[model samples]
Target: MFRKRSKTTENTAATASTAVRPVWTFSSSGWLFLYHFGVIKCLKDLDLHRQVYTIGSSGGSCAGAFLHMDTDIDEVVRFVLSCALEARSSFSGLFQLKRYLKNAIRKFGTAELPNKLEGNYEISVSQLPWLRNRRITKWRDMEDVEQSILASSCAVPLAGLPVNVPGLGYCIDGMFSDSQLIKALVLGNSYFAYHDHASVTICPFYSSRAHITPSEYVPLWWAFFPPSPEELWRVYKLGQKDARAWVIKNRGRTNLTVTPIPDLTDEPEATVLQDGWHAWENVGEEISMLATGAVARLWSALSHVLEALGWTLVYWELAVHTVLSAVVAALAPVLPDSLKAGGSTAMAWKRCRDYYALLLSLKMVLKMVPALGGRIRMGMDAIDRIFSLSFCFRLFWFLKQSA
Candidate 1:
């Protein structure tokens, strides 16, 4: 009886220690960090944080740190709110947010990071112009951590520049690499080899069960221009509410997965319906290409015509006014002072001349207001690139080969 009881206890202990751990992965979410805070609170409430391992990329790195530490949720809320307010207070661009982030991290960041032994956490970043993704589990000091977080958050064109980390080289946003399915597949294969855990992804924006399209559009927009305190609070609460629902539904679950939203540039998988070649199918494609190209060219030509007509009207108006002013000056002697508002004819004529010159100067400067021509050209170019006939042909050929 004693031997059986000891065996039972040992089995339970082994299961408790070696059971599949929860791997929580967070994607980069700028001001949307509030949503993550709410989710983390839900996890902590259920005493699940102790059993969860975290992986974060970009802005997620900051959230991941908070999750790893014994930090209060309220403290994190205050931190997030304060950071957003400060970053958005004096500026109107994402670059300002970057500056404020660096300053805040330097002021408040500590040189000591909690060891993975304390709680497993990983940060992801992409080395610029070359490598798409790299995950770091160890850090040398406060600066490294700060740089890593900033590097991961760097979105090209939108956010000013990629961060230069001492050992990581120049790096951009981690989302750029993982946004691709092929890259994500590679990462997944490698991730399972080293980490013996089941991952649960909690996305605040969109999910298969929920289609929050409006929220999907604002992830970066909010970072560029942080919303009102009321809106931020609402989003945070929504995240908490969603997370609680998720927990209720997925309680005692061992495996969970969340799909990342694809960007506009992400290549979709090519599907082939038939194995045999059909040359006749090219007719519809060719027709589509011709129609789209003709429409684009027509629009471009119309814009140019309108612009020219607008300028011609402006010039004509100026010429007509000049002729009228000259006629007025010539007839000033014959005209009554009442026509000039009780002023002398000479004074009225001088004022008229000055007004004509002012109008002429202003009209000339209208051309300097910035050219719509370049904008029209840019639009046409975008249409050509996005709806190119060559791309369609290439896609058709690929599908044929794949089939």
Candidate 2:
């Protein structure tokens, strides 16, 4: 969609002419290392990685280390796949896998790691107590850098324990704070006096801030389980595809003097006038899609509630009948013999007991209905998943783009 160039865009263009470096920011991609690995491979293939600035968080930090060190592409891929397998094997195996990854980072990582002031690499981590996100640029040595990477990648309650940064108390995943990479980018920009405007944001999930065309959202199971070879290959290829699309999209804006970019002459572009019209059309389409999806989901929920209510009414009717029968049976024996001539106390009591049993069964069935007992458990889970990024925010983005 065409958007009128804002002050940010204007500044970006102005900075682009003055040999601005491309800033590659990576999101906290848990277990999706291969995805960012693929993007790195593509960027390197296009000769874009050499002069780029890197900002990463969580799994992205790990990949940033690789990029900073210019590690072997194939080796990084193999190491990532192996780490995934090791982590998925057992709980203890995850610790072992972390150690292995740390060693790998230390082996490749230089003694002097990148920081905001001097280097092209920075890793973000969530600081404890206040629970704020901060970038680690300066390090004691490669060992410190490795530990920082561990702390950044450590997702509490799931992956492993939070690593305690020497002065930062117990630090967890950078995602606890800057899950979207917005804060990191802002900090990165400010460090460069806002001259570093050439941004290539790569989110593992589909994000509005990313340059690449959004890929399929990764399932939560992939975070804990090692993907099969076929699945891994698919994600890798998807990354490559999106990276290429990013190159094509930004080819027109990049400065030619920095590096020789591949000429994607066959790719088409729309004029400024066309863009405005198309932008409005896109907006309309997105609005309609969102409205339709909302209506459909509401209808589905309503139908489920109505069905449960219908079943509840049937069960309640039976329960009411049982209660009335039980009362009559119990009262029948206590009534005058003239009024209840055919009823025996023993039979009446038995009938009352039977009615009580029937009432219990009806109560159990009522609780089973979705509108009743099941709601509590399901509601809690739904809320948890929604807040925990399990419920894909990309669904809305996907719907917007699908049209």
Candidate 3:
């Protein structure tokens, strides 16, 4: 889930009054995961440049002008630590919530992934002969139920997924070019065709079962992207990395595996499922270090570009959450009765911690103002403090005292 910056002018009175709330999210082909062109255009409409701020960046519009251009290993470590600390605050939580809530409200009542095919609900406006239009109408509010209707959803190399009809041919890198077949995938196209219960696979993986399984869209995203195991090794090789050499040099050990592609068909054109790439996932080399180094290279390049543009990483805290987690984690150690009281005690602790933080922050303000002014002040302060944590730390200390 994410919050979009309000379209309202950042300087406007109403814009100043916006409250932080959680944004609701749904995985879909229609939204969030737009096509390449769509995403470039959508980014233009976002609040990223004008209303957004980043404390450290390489190339985006809001890269902080204050960013130190001459960065070293130490600086990167410092920045990462700062980012991690900032993420754990109360205000950051609000940002997440507000983004989530705003997204939820903005995208409420939209279509969702299906649970299965031919189970219930309709897809693509087709009123199958066996069902009345009212039966489908009754389920418009339920996206999952609607998605289950004989949609052509696609699955990937993942061990488990919904099945409509198995692919007649295996797709390389999980790409599907077939129009009718691809359209069946909720991740591919939103189109659907009418099929009677007998024709339908009734399995959740079938994209044809649109109304049958709406939640299936998320896995589709990973299938669309992410490197294949082959690509992972190729990338490492192309980058002049040699974890294998390091392993041989240090431990005289090399992990090897014979991955076999599953032959699902008998034809010449049949693609194979390159399973048993367990060696790649299970390699004993410095795999994590290699992966991290590769990612860092890209991130470093991007950071440099964004930094040149004055973008900075914006940091915020969800503090009501910040201390409550600590209290919850430490309760078992500090309190003799904590284990016996169980998880509920920690939950209750969080609820009260949140309430008290809110109350305390409210009381910090002058009490004589009218309700509107007070609200405005609180909203403005919440917005202000999101950009910095000095005030939050003070509040954190106050909350601890009360606790």
Q: Considering every candidate listed, which one attains the maximal lDDT? A: 2
State which candidate, 1 or 2, has the greater lDDT: 2
State in Å the error of residue 34, model 3. Answer: 23
Candidate 3 deviant stretches above 4 angstroms: 1-221, 229-315, 320-345, 348-403
Q: What is candidate 3's lDDT per residue for 152-192, written digit by digit as tens? A: 12222221222221211111111121113332221122222
For residue 289, give model 3's deviation from the true position in Å.
Answer: 18
Q: How many angstroms is residue 204 displaced in model 1 relative to the true structure, after the best TM-score fit?
A: 2.6
Could you give me the TM-score of model 1 versus the true structure? 0.51
What are the per-residue Cα lDDT tens digits for candidate 2 across 108-163? 66655544223566666777767676666567655567677888888775556778
* TM-score of each model, in listed order: 0.51, 0.55, 0.16
Tell me the deviation in Å of residue 378 in model 2.
Answer: 29
| Candidates in order: C-alpha RMSD to true structure | 28.2, 23.1, 26.5
lDDT of 1 by residue, 1-403 (tens): 0011121121111123334566676666677766777777666766677776676766666766666556677666776677676656665544565665676566545555535323366666777677556666566667677777787777765566888876667988776654533211211111111111224654444211121111221233454467766566656665655666666556546443323322313422112212323322232333344566778566555544444444344444544544555665667688653232213556545534643563455433343233343232223342222222122232433433333
